[model samples]
Target: MDKLRSLTLFLATCEEQSFAAAARVCNTDPSTISKAVSRLEAELGVTLFQRSTRQLKITAAGRHYAQTVRSSILALSSCEDELRQLNDAPRGRLRVNSAVCYGHLYLRPLLKAFCQRYPEITLELSLDDMHVDIIEQDIDVALRTGFVKDSRLVARCLSPMDFVVCASPDYLKQHDMPVSLDDFNGHSWIGFKIKETQQLQPIFLPDADGVYQLCELHRTHITDDGEAMAQLCADGFGFAQLPHFLAKAGLKSGALVSLYPAFRAPMPDSGVFAIYPKRAYLPARVRVFLDFLVTALEAQQETPTHTWAQHWPPHVQFD
Candidate 1:
């Protein structure tokens, strides 16, 4: 029972009084923790905790078990730390997840460098636009964009990818250019859809007379792929809004044009971050990848699109 994680978590649940709180401390799911506790109660054939809708009260056996588990876990960690000190290098599989556009547009190069740095570290990279359960998925770290919400993981800001309003050169030349936000009403719009929601997301832009308004978008073409939107917009389909960093190359190479230079409103909360489970010691692989990502993003910002335009293709290299 002492060697089993379910038993250990059962003790943690009784001590914490809440399954969610124990899950956070142990870096697991709340449901998993609760199930473990329930299983422990069934196996022991004693009601370890008195459960009510309002609170969980620990029985005498629960308190005794919690105390015993706490001391034993601590002792095990102390023993493990001495052996870990002898192995200076962190050699393990480091799993990472990121948005598809962000992953290809940014981290591919950075990850290449990271793999070079730590030859022993195996990377399992998953690219998806939707939010994922890092702990449950066994993800070591994630490079995420926009707002950071989870308190269970520690977030480190890597960079801010500024957003912009864009349209195809041909489309802008064919139609009357929108002078202000209210001007958007007359234009055919391409929008981004969050896959998890399967609904169109609002793209905030300055409305009539240059007043920023979070307008509900009525999109003619809405898709989950950011690249698809950009491509469709480039093909003179409709105006699409995208991150400035993403459009910078297209804007330079005469593929896409910034719709409103002055009114390309960037949201204040759109900070890119690297999130990871809260651990006592961050593994070297995670640190190395984060450092590489920061360096790559900073270099991208410092060197203008024209600098890369001469060497690299104008549109997305990967997609």
Candidate 2:
């Protein structure tokens, strides 16, 4: 029996706690895995697991041994990765998770270009609107809007994403463009849910006796989905506070009119973000992608109104 295979088999068995699972990881049969573990136990003169009819439990010695062996395996893998990158070509399948609209509008093209440039690299993309635990999902990178307050990950700022308070031109013509924050209470509101803050921040600006103020409440329409909210507002249902990136075309084409023009509202956070696990020695692929995005975003800021072009792709980027 190969000693490395036996050691890895023992490690996998310790992690998965089942002969079938360990065998699957090792690309062999459960009997092969069991035989390897038995050989390991024989060589070490110690049983690592105390197995029962219904369950498998690690022995006290096994617990300590597993930690040591796991660390060794990780170190070896890291070394292999370093060697791979040092060869001047980083190659692997990187998993990326992001929200729906941003993935479509922004990340899609950038990712496409990246993959085209590096044919050796592949991407597994997950587009979702809900927040998830990055560690639990085994995600290599995540792109999210606004703030991520969890102390576990590192949040990098990409660009200043502002809001556009808008409603379709027809809707505004029919409904009163209430002149004050208090006036917004009576008007229909389209609420956008902020995952980071866990808050529904709508676009409601009002003048409190000649003084400008922000109205973040009195939501008549609330949805966790942004695309649906935008459609409803575009169809003349109500006012929707949308990201500048998402609302530009509608505003420019006269389909939607920007509301509260005089008083501008702070974005609360950046729309473009590059998030990753907070640890030293970042992966080459992740670093390259992050740098590429930051550069692309800066190029976009110099020409601010490009997002309003009808021909412009949903995610505004240089083609």
lDDT of each: 0.70, 0.69
Q: State residue 123's C-alpha deviation in candidate 2, in Å.
A: 0.4
For each candidate in turn, the TM-score is 0.67, 0.68
lDDT of 1 at 212: 57
Off by over 4 Å in 1: 1-87, 207-211, 262-268, 302-319
Worst 10 residues of 2 by lDDT: 310-319
lDDT of model 2, residue 48: 87
- Badly placed stretches (over 4 Å) of model 2 are 1-76, 147-152, 193-199, 202-212, 261-271, 302-319
TM-score of 2: 0.68
**Across residues 1-319, which tens digit of lDDT does each residue of candidate 2 receive?**
8887787888878768998998897799999988987787788899888878788788998877777776565556556666676665756778899878888767787877788877877789999877866654557788887656777678886655556667787777897667555566788877877655678864535454534456556677777777777778889888787876677556657677665432335545544667776654566777777777777766665122223232333221111
RMSD, every candidate, angstroms:
8.8, 6.9
